[model samples]
Target: MAGVLIGLALLAFWLFSLFDVITAPEEEVRNVPKALWVLIVVLIPLLGGLIWMLRGRPKVVRDPWPVPPGPGMPKGPDDDPDFLRDLDRRMRGED
Candidate 1:
């Protein structure tokens, strides 16, 4: 019974860490980020369960794929709306 309880505790910790790492933002990956490293821990519950260990980890932020923002325009999602309004203002030469 004691072993079973310990196993359950490890599983719970693994699942919690897994969910956190999977959803965490990329900018914070340098930090703990809910201890994604837990997946790499041997004899732990999540050791062999992570797909990233075999396949690959995705670039959750700023994928290298091409974007249509074009040159001389803002380069972010925020830039999109501001760029449109800025273009309108520029054409009208308004402040």
Candidate 2:
């Protein structure tokens, strides 16, 4: 039972690593050429998966907070001058 569970886990890891390697964009795959990484994962599943997760995956850059719209850009309908003007005209029954 324990052995089967371990085997399934390893299998899942191998499949996930293989899929990730295949789908990753060429520019985003780090440390090795995408083809080489695929080969490594296919040939040595456990170790290769670990290495790929640690070193070959793309580095994700995340902003700590959402960026506000640039100057002159409306964040919502309420912030858009044209939209407000149109709404006012509609309220007054102007064409």
Candidate 3:
């Protein structure tokens, strides 16, 4: 029935929210302490879940492109200009 489906959906949402709260990193939790957020979600499932999703969740800012390593941190031999130049000299029989 429609009511049963709605109940199941709400239950699923509550469970997901609870899991999220438990797994969220301490530094990422906002508005209140992580323990307090967990208590809120456990005590008042629907409203707490909504509030957490809206306010407590971390504001993740993802870069579209992968970040290159900082200067002097070569990711690979090919990426290191000095290595490549040395390799080229060795290949050409230069000292």
Candidate 4:
């Protein structure tokens, strides 16, 4: 029947919400603590699931890309002008 299908759907939604709450990281859960959220979801399935969806999830934060190293860094001895000059002098046998 239509009523039975609706009930099952609601039950499935509630169970999914309950599992999400139980598995969510402690710090990521907002408004209520993880344990309390689990109780809420289990005790009053439909309403609690709605509440968790509305207020229990953490906002996602995207980090900015890190700055690259400055030109002061040399990739290798051959790429450094000073090192190249020193190598040339050494090759000419200068002290």
What are the clash counts of all predictions, listed in order? 0, 0, 0, 0
Local distance difference test, candidate 1: 0.57
Best prediction by TM-score: 2
Q: What lDDT does the true structure give each of the candidates? A: 0.57, 0.96, 0.95, 0.89
Tell me the tens digit of each residue's lDDT in model 1 across 48-84: 3444333333344675677576687777755688778
Give the per-residue lDDT of model 4 (tens digit) for 22-93.
888899999878999999999999999999999996677876677554688777788799999999999999
Please identify model 4 stretches exceeding 4 Å from their true place: 62-95
RMSD of 2: 3.2
RMSD each, Å: 11.9, 3.2, 5.3, 9.0
Cα lDDT tens digits for candidate 3, 21-58 = 99999998898999999999999999999999999988
What range of 10 consecutive residues in model 4 has the weakest lDDT sum?
Answer: 61-70
Q: Best to worst by TM-score, what's the order?
A: 2, 3, 4, 1
Order of the predicted models by lDDT, top scorer first: 2, 3, 4, 1
| Candidate 4 all-Cα RMSD | 9.0
TM-score of decoy 4? 0.62
Candidate 3 worst ten-residue window by lDDT:
63-72
